[model samples]
Target: MQEILDRAKDCYDSGLPFVVYRKPNETDVFGVFQSNDELRSSKDFTEKGFVFAPFNDDNQVVLLQPDEVWEGKYQTEKSEAIKDINLDESGKEVHIELVKKGIQEIETGRLQKVVLSRKIQVRITKPPFKIFKTLLSKYPNAFAYFIHHPKVGTWCGATPETLVKVKDKKLKTMSLAATLPFIEDETPKWGNKEIEEQQMVSEYIGDKLAHTMERLEIDEAESVRAGNLWHLRSEVRGTMLPNLKVSEVVRALHPTPAVCGIPTDEAQKFIHKNENYKRTFYTGFLGELNLRSQGELSLFVNLRCMELQGDTASIFVGGGITEASDPESEWIETQNKSKTMLGIL
Candidate 1:
């Protein structure tokens, strides 16, 4: 464990590309160190390394060529609460207005739903490596990773949403939506708006997978907690057709109703027209592709994450907005979500 940490620090200090990650509910930690500073792209998924893809398909998908791979087992450590950083009031107002606009579109029947997001930049007093370690200790149930590339910059996150996982002929995914603040020893209650929103995502996933899957199964939705918030989630599994490829499964699953909206294309257009900021890698997916000699893949949505640039950290948060959604309440939901990353800092 100490060797992995030391090597990761050396890679970071030398400005070389590398990715260190641990999957949810797993004790094993994995790191891939690239030999050179070159940034490579993976279009066919034939390359053997970690892939960092963006939300938009037009952008390049950065790949970290594995010059060396290391694995270690470590016991989970308890987390300590860090001070909360206050969000900019002006920025909150702007995000609320964006949500209102999305609601108006839904009401007019132009779109059934659209996910809105805001990026908050916070000044960091601690080193990024320490924050990365804190994230792993705090979110043991998340897909946590720290990726650095000379071309793409440095990014880290502890994501709860699994976009897709493939091993041999089997494929698995999940539809996660809705949000409520978690209280100790209290039952989580979901409003109609949340229920409907989560359902839309599940149905959308089922429909998309049907095209390429030989057999598909979906489980009932249930409440799952992540840090200070609780979300409704449903698991989806299937056996892929022989002709289907890894890239095809990713395309069908990513930017689902949970992150994009009910009708994928239309919702994406609205976001591009109004969000007022580029999502970049915020809602993007990242993980190992074709790991080892065997064909096993694990990819996750980029949530509960931040981008480190010098001393400032840009935190990303978003929520699904429907016709019944309230602008102020949605704003508060994002604030609660941001705490997942903020508490580690």
Candidate 2:
């Protein structure tokens, strides 16, 4: 860690922005990359960088350069706790209460879609980045990210959600996801509500990208079940502008309505005010800036994340709250999401 930190500092001093991270569950090899003007790929893993899979199901790695590497340490304040938070509020008043609140928001026009999150505290000293790397190498579909700063240590997740993807001036994005626990051989059916929710997301993204790209191609996406929940997902592809920086596109589209909310500013404000937690980097996006190629950035929402504060590990979880969304069901959804990593613990 010290060696990489020192090297990153050197690169920063030399005016080169870089990012460093480790895949979940893998050791000895960490991801590193130096920013370039365009996108490229690497077959040889000599230069430290991230290895990304081409498709969602491809368990391949893509080497990337980061702008910063962060290592986080949790610090607790001196305060007496009131009550013990439940690990999975599958059947509880809290779940119902949250859904009701979301309904109210919908009725009042505060938001069209809002993503809610919760923090889970586990007891352990193992660095989360270490586990993150393991997941990366093991899950071909999983993605890993870690952003280290002096004051903040933020890591990445092995999420299947694609905020956006670009190659050879061809751009693609997805409306992913509304999730429930994955059940085997369930026939992957999409009810009216699920399909409608997914369509909303797809249309929103397509409209958002329409002016920037030409000839958009949208296809019917299927349902993707993760852990204990299922989400509605769709893929939207198009051609990029002749001169559009991958970074520019990323900045324009990150913290999407799927993760944040529609009228994103209002939804984010509500979240900060009502959620009653410092999300730090929970829903933020992090990935490689430049890989074996130039102008390529792979960033994923910081979901399924846990923070190591001393001997305590706090895992974060949340769900999208819509007008049609029930607070109780939303809460249960989060509980189900928590089970994904809690099982590992």
Candidate 3:
């Protein structure tokens, strides 16, 4: 573990690209160290390296060549923190207004749904690697990763949403949406708006997979807890059609309704015009793409994530907005979502 950290620090100091990650529910951690400072991209999954893509297709997909690899079991420890993050009330009001505008568009039938997001900047006292270690110890069930590239910047996240997973001819994905703070005493009672929001994502994923899957199956929706919040989740599985490439599947499933909205192009346009911030890689998917040795691919939605630069961290959070969405409640939901990263900080 110490060696991996030291190597990562060396790479960062030397301006080399590298990525270290621990897959969901696994104790083993893997690191890929690129030999050069070049930024690489791939459209097909034939490359043998780690891929870091952005939310926007126009942006470059950064890849780190697997020149050096390290694997070790992550040592887990309790994380103690002294600070509490306060919600930005003014920022919340601004996001609420954006949600209201989205709702008005929905009422007029411009789009069925839209995912709105906001960024919160916070001052940090701990080293970025220390916070990343805390995240690894905290969220064992999430795809925890710390990626650094001189050209692309540094990001660390513990994402709970799986964009897609493929092994052999079988493919697996999930529709994850509808967030609320978790309570210990009782079962979560989801409102109609939450239920419908989740349903839209499930239906959209199923429809999209139909294009490349010979047979598709969607499981019943259920409530799953991630950190301090609960979200509605549904698993979708299918057998891949003959000759279906990894890029095609990714193009179809990415920026799902869970992250974007129904009628993807229109919702994306709305977000681009009104969100007033660059999403960069917040909602983008990242992970191994068709690893040659394993013959499998696993990618996750970039949520519960933060970009570390010097002593400041930029945290990103968002939620799906339908016509039945409440602007105030949506604001609260993002605050709850922020706890996933803030707690470890």
What TM-score does candidate 3 get on C-alpha atoms? 0.97
lDDT of 2: 0.58
Of the two candidates 2 and 3, the one with more favorable TM-score, higher being better, is 3
Error of 1 at 143 (Å): 0.7
TM-score of each: 0.97, 0.72, 0.97
Q: Write the per-residue lDDT of candidate 3 for residues 264-286, one digit (tens) a residue.
A: 98999999999969999999989
Clashes of each: 0, 62, 0
Per-residue lDDT tens digits for candidate 1, residues 1-345, read 667878988999998999888899898989899988987999777778899999888898888888899998756777676675675566777898899899988988879889989888888987987888888998889998989998899999899989898998798899899999999999898999999999988888999999999999999999999878899999999999998887888888878888889788889989988997899998989999887754678889988899999999998888999999999999999888888777777
Give the TM-score comparing model 1 with the true structure, all chains together: 0.97
**Each prediction's whole-model lDDT (CA):** 0.88, 0.58, 0.88
Write out the backbone clash pairs for model 1: none
In candidate 2, clashing pairs total: 62
- For residues 92-158, what per-residue lDDT tens digits would candidate 2 score against the true structure? 5654665567668878987777777767676863454445434444344444444333223333355
lDDT of 1: 0.88
